[model samples]
Target: MTSSTHPFEQEEVMAYLDGELSANRAANVAAHLRECAECAALAEQMRDVSVRLSDWSVEPAPANLTKNLEAARAEHVVAKVRKPRGFTGRLGGKFPFLRNRWVWAAASVAALLILVLRIGLPTARQESRQSEGLQLAYTEQSRSADTPESKAVGTASDNFKVRPAPPALPASRGSSPKFSSSSADGQSNPEPTAPMIARTASVSLTVKEFAPLEASVKAIAQRHNGYIASLTSNSPQDAARTLSATLRIPSAQLESAISELKQLGRVEQESQTGEEVTKEFTDRAARMKNARATEERLLDVLRNHTGQVKDILATEQEIARVRGDIEQMEADQRSLQTRVDFATVELSVQEEYKASLQGAPTATATRLHNAAVEGYRSAIESLIGLGVWALQALPTILLWAIALFAPGRWIWKRVRRTSVSQS
Candidate 1:
């Protein structure tokens, strides 16, 4: 059919009306639309449809929509340029939903939530267990308040308060008591208690006399069967003397030691901290026990087993590994025990210092004589220093002077000769 008579000629005219056709095609369609009444009517109808769609009011697109569209277009171009290969490409092409931004975003959020649940749940459970253990320890301490001194110390500090421990559980059958919420029933288990806490304290004091305070601190440590881990005294001539000491006291004696130490001076600042190492200690003990068991099993195997040389060597290596693990675990247990047994006290003592104005002034004549002698000495020293510096630089100066002198003299002679010639 002739171009003007073809059915698609009307579509071309509509495309021209919407400015969708290339310039050349649009020109042809425009020419056809002007001559043919049918094509012109079709173009007019399409224009009306466009106007009607524009009139249907809708919310404006979000500001980021343009950026997203541009990004999508770029990604599309890249995908087309380098068509993906393999199973991934085939799967993605078959399921176009996988290419959606929202789908990927949702998947990422789901993955993050799963990861958080996996990691956070166990950590939260462990913390809850530790807290239960601390509660149990505090509860045990509260039932028997035999120490009047500790009570007094607690009463003296406003920040200190006795937290009554939670209700005790029924005695279970074992050397180490196991407390749980559940009792032969399918229910939630009571939280487990940890072992003990390593406590520490820091006290800063302003004392009238540093020496007496120092002596008192040592006495207090000795009385408690504790020893001074370290002691430092800083005394400046015109300033107050300060004493810093780290004291290690038996955990049982910590309260009494702190109270007695405070009595030696005016307490300026004091802070106490208790770190519950019960869980850590318990874990180390369990590990050590397991290691010992493993070592014993290996020892039995080594003693009883009669096998090939290769088998014996392999068994020996296993025994060695088990022994090493046992040693390491034992060391950890000892370190933990040491911390639980001894509490650290960091004490800082500063003397309430006063400046003294008791010294007599020097005689004017004597002062003048001293000043003159000092000035003379300084001048002599300065001269000596200058002579030494000049001597040190003498060779370099001479070398530079010699290097420049010949050239300078020759240039002068040449200038003189030129001047003479000119005259």
Candidate 2:
């Protein structure tokens, strides 16, 4: 019906009948349907059509059609499954290199060998060149020295094998510091630099006099131009007093300090160890060089940036990060240097104790109380242990019982039958 003649349009009425309209609109349509017979009749006809659609059903497909669909599906699946693969595809599914375990092992070994050679060859060549240079320098120095004093020094140099120092690595800001190889007379005096070694020593002693032991330990450290890192002293009421201290001493004076410490008491145990850290120091120095280079590049970028604020900020952030890394690495280098410069000594001293019959013994009541407490603790522990065992073994026990139940019953029944038959 036209909207001019009716309050609701035909589409609105149909939507109301289909329950698609909002609640208020649907209520108004219902009220209008109750008052207007013609609109109500039209709504009734729409509802009747919807009811017919809801009840209607399509006929099932013919049996041959179902069979034909099934056959088509099977043919498509077969075609997909039987698709031909290229040589590369087949090889990809089963790689030739993976077929034999020995091939993988051989390849791994070859790669490892190549890596070792690559890393070792350059180092070996550098060392050889350094040694040759050192030898030639020694020869020149020996020829230059003709005086008796110089001759004696030259003969001494001949007996020693001079090792050349490694090439100077790049520093953070300035050039690496150089050591003068010439004497005050401007004559070359080649002295071999020793490899860096961090020394550690442990000494145990039994002292007769405990009064001066602590002072002696401290004196030993001070004498060697070192400091006590940690010290712990325990003096029991009736037992021998003990003192333990960890000391850091100049490696040059380590032997002397250890000998002096041994004289303070009868030596019970003594041991010394050294760890070479030249390579470790070299590696860290190289890394610091690279980090400093990165920081310098970032600083340059930050200074020359004519780009957006964000780009400048990002560059500044990167510079800050690199600077932080450089500082941390510098601190690490200092710590490593300290280790090489100092030797660690672990000292333990015990005072000699003589037993005397003057001290009072433990009371009987106190001993009885301790015994009772220990007994209670033992009983509780035993109970806890039993509970734990049961918890751990219950499942296994139940499983075995279930598994053996049937066979056990069969065996019992056969035994009873045999006994009855014999009776």
Candidate 3:
């Protein structure tokens, strides 16, 4: 490695004979060996060592190794013949010759699928429960306008609650703007909500664009002093969303709001209903007055009466009853206020847009093309699923496939003979 020494020194000369010298350095060694008898003798000695070691040899391989590999193949063939024709077996590649095993696996899958289709799939218990819950919830919702029991609780919290009933229509009408802000409370002078027939109207529509409709609908509802009640949106075939929302706007804004909503999209469906609760309202008015009169008498007794322990307790009880009655009446008033302040309109909106499609409303050729493409995609996906399932059950499927198939059955017997004979 050093630059100072001759590369073809005697040791280098010997290394050259051993073929261990670097090519360029070996050339130098070869030249030295040629010029010096002593170095050439060293090279001769190294060559002699190599010649003596060349006599070493390894033992020959056994003749049966090929036979063993072949036997394994034959046994695999036999095993394939004996297994059951189950889907898992058909798809599994545990056995040889089941490389396209997904077919059997798919067959197995088809059995369960066939059963499902033939019998008609039963609803999942959880889904059934949820449906029942929604039905019950809807039923409950329908009945919860205002109630005598809820009104009797007698608290400020009652003002925030919604009760089951047709809300009382205020005497004033057509006073509030489409949408105008309230200071949360009446000011020096405030216009009251007008008496109007309580009603519910719902509409379903499909729009090519959703954002504009969303914004416009929201604006209209706000203009009407309404809030969105509920919403849901989803699209299975396209990257589009269907939106369903219930907007609660002031009854005064009803007509304008409906017109604006209609302008947003082509209407698919529409329905409306008006509910009358005049007699019910009248009955409540009378009951409230009676409660007030009872309460006044109780207050008088509390202020003026002095009696035994039992008498005082009895009077106190009456006072509590009257107070409860008064509280109930106040709760009813607030419920009526809410109904008078807002109206409910349920709307369902859908956007129609699919990126994969070309222009709208074409002929059957386009439909056929799209359907065929979709069908092909579905088939490929099904095959892929079957392949995966077979692969997963490969160990088990192989056992069966080998037992059932021609090559697999042949290989199976061979494997059994070999394994048994070897044992």
Best-fitting candidate, measured by lDDT?
Answer: 2
Residue lDDT tens for model 2, 117-146? 644454343344446443212233333335
Q: Residue-pair clashes per candidate, as listed?
A: 5, 0, 49
lDDT (tens digit, per residue) of candidate 1 on 1-423: 346555455556666776899988878777767787877777788888999999989899998999998998897876654546853354345456555669779967975785456344543544454476532222333323364533333221111222232213211111112122222332122222333556789999999977777788888887766678899999998899999999976665678789999988899999988776657755665565455555665576568756567766766787788778867765665565555556789999999999988678999999999999999999999999999999999999999999999999999999999999999
Model 3 has a clash total of 49
CA lDDT of each candidate?
Answer: 0.65, 0.66, 0.57
Task: Identify the superior model by TM-score, candidate 1 or candidate 2.
Answer: 1
Candidate 3 local accuracy as lDDT? 0.57
lDDT digits (tens) for residues 120-156 of candidate 3: 4222322343354321111222123365522232111
User: TM-score of each candidate?
Assistant: 0.48, 0.43, 0.39
What does candidate 1 score in Cα RMSD to the true structure? Answer: 19.4
Please identify model 1 stretches exceeding 4 Å from their true place.
1-195, 306-325, 362-380, 405-423
